[model samples]
Target: MEIDRLTVRFGELTAVHDLTLNSDCGEVLALLGPNGAGKTTTVETLEGFLSPTSGTVRVAGHDPVADHDLVMARLGVMLQSCRLYSAITPLEALRLFASYYRRALDPAPLLERVGLTHRRAIAWRKLSGGEQQRLALALALVGRPDVVILDEPTSGLDVEGRLLVRRIVAELRQSGTCVLLTSHELSEVEKMADRVAIIDGGRLRAVGTPAELAAADRRPEIRFSAPAHLDRAALASHLDATVTQPEPGRFILALEPTPAAIAELTVWLAERNIALSDLSTGVASLEDVFLRLTGEHQPEAKGPGQTP
Candidate 1:
C-alpha cells in the first residue's frame, strides 16, 4: 500500500496534508501521532472508508477510491472500537465474518490463537474487554487478507492478550502480509514496528526505525542507583538535563550523551562522596521524539530497570 501526497479536508479544516507513506508485504509500519494529528483521516482514506480530498491512495496497485471493492477484498481493518451485535456468540461472529470472503480461514484455530476459545460460546455482550479485543482481532484475520490495518490493536488488553497481538503481528510479517498499525503504546511500537512514521498537526514530522529517531534526537539518559535526596537541582545545574529520582535509591539523569557530561557527572558524584552505582545510558525513546515533535510533555519513562 502507498499513500502518495494524500490530503483530506473537512470544510475549511485540512485534516491530513500531503502525507506520503508506503508499506509492503512482510513489513509492519507503525503510524504514530498525538491527538488531532490526522492519523485517523489518513488511515480511513487508505481503508476506503473515506475518499481523499486530494492526492492519491493505492492499495495493491489499485486506487482505493476508484477500486473500493477490490481494496476492501484485499484488506482487513480493525478499528479502535468494535461494536458487535450484543447477542452474537464469538463463534457465531467469526462464522458470519468468514462468509463474506471468497476464501476465509477456519475460525476454530483462530479462536485458539487469540485465546478466545473459552469465550467462543459466550454472547458478545458478556465477554470481557480483552476477550472482545481478541475476538475483534480474529474477525480481522478471518478474510486472510493481504493487507491488515489495525488501530490500537492492543488497547485495554491484559499482558497475555497483548502478547497474543505481538505474536500474531510477527507471524503475519513472516507470512509476507503487509501490516499498518497505530498505537499509543510507544514501547510496543519501538519493539514491533519495522518502521515508524511520526506525524503532527497534519504533517509528517519524522520517519525512521526507532533507533534512528533516538540517535537523531541525541538526548541520552543515564540511570543509576543513588539516594532519593541526591540533590536533583544541583545535578541539573551540572549538565543540560533534568535529574530526578523516581524511586528511593534510584536516580535518572537526562542529558546529551557527551563524554564530557559523563566525566563531569562522575567527578561531581565522587566529590560529594556519593557512590553512583549501576550507571547505564540509553538513547532518546519514541516517547521522547514524540514529545519533541508534538510539543507535548510525556512523563519520563519509568525504567531502564537497573540496566538488566
Candidate 2:
C-alpha cells in the first residue's frame, strides 16, 4: 500500500495532512499515534470508507477510492466499532459472514485459531469484551484477505487475550498477509510491528523500524546512586550530561555525544574516584522515541460518541 501526499479534511479542519507512507507485501506496518491524530482517517481512506480531500491512495496497485469493489475483495477490515446480531451465536455469526465471500477458511478452524471454538454456541451478546474483539478478528480473516487492517484489535483484552491476538498476528505474517494495525499498546507494537509510522496532528512525523527510530535519536543514558547529601548540581557540572533526580539519591542522565559519552563519563567518574552503582547505557526505545516526537504521553481525543 502507498499513500502519497494524502490529505483529508472535515469542513475546515484537516484530519490528515500531506501524509505519505508505504508497506511492503506480507509486512506489518503499525500506525502509532494518539487519538484524533488522523490514524483512523488514514486507514479509513485506504479501506475505501472515506475519500481523501487531496492526494492519492493506492492499495495493491489499485486506487481505493476509485476501485472500491476491487480493493474490498482483497482486503479484510476490523474497525474499532462493529455492529453484529446480538441474538446469534459465534458460529452462526461466522457462518453468516463467511457466506459473503467466494473463498473462505472453514469456520471451525477459524474459531479455534481465535480461541472462540469453545464458545461457538454462545450468544454474541454473552461474550466479554475480549471475546468480542477476537470474534471481530475471526470475521476479518474469514475471507483470507491478502491485506488485513485491524484497529485496536486488543483493546480491553486481558493478558491471555492479548497473547492470543499476538499469536494470530504472527501466523498471518507467516502466511504472507500484509497487516496494518493501529494500536496504543506500545509493548505490543514493539513486538509485532515490522515497521512503524508515527502520525500526529494529522501529519506523518516519522516512519521506520523501531530500532531505526530509536537510533535516529540515539542518546546515552546513565543511572547511578549517590549519597543523599551529595550536591547534584556539583556532580552534574562535573559530567558532560544532563541529570534528573528521579528519586532521592537516584539520578538519570542524558549524555551529549562528544567522543563516546559513556567512556568519557567513566573517565570523569573514575577521576573523582566516585564508585557508581547500577550504571548502564543504551539507545532509546520505540516508546521513548514516540514520546519525544509526538509529545503524547497519553491517549488523545476520543472518537465521536465514544468515551475518552
Candidate 2 residue 49 C-alpha distance from true site, Å: 1.5
Q: How close is candidate 1 to the true structure, as a TM-score?
A: 0.84
Residue 187's lDDT within candidate 1 is: 87
- Point to the candidate with the largest lDDT: 1
Note the Cα lDDT for every prediction shown: 0.85, 0.82
Model 1 lDDT tens row, 199-246: 998999999988888889765677678866677667776664666564
Question: What ranges in model 1 sit over 4 Å off?
Answer: 220-234, 238-260, 263-282, 298-308
Q: What's the residue-level lDDT of 29 in candidate 1?
A: 96
Residues 1-308, candidate 2: write the lDDT tens digits.
88999999999999999999988777999999978999999999999989989999988889987898788878888988866889899899999889878898899999998889899999989998888999999999998898999998889889998998899889889999889999999889999999999999999889999999988967766656765444555556666345655445555565554456667666766777776675645676687777768874432222233333
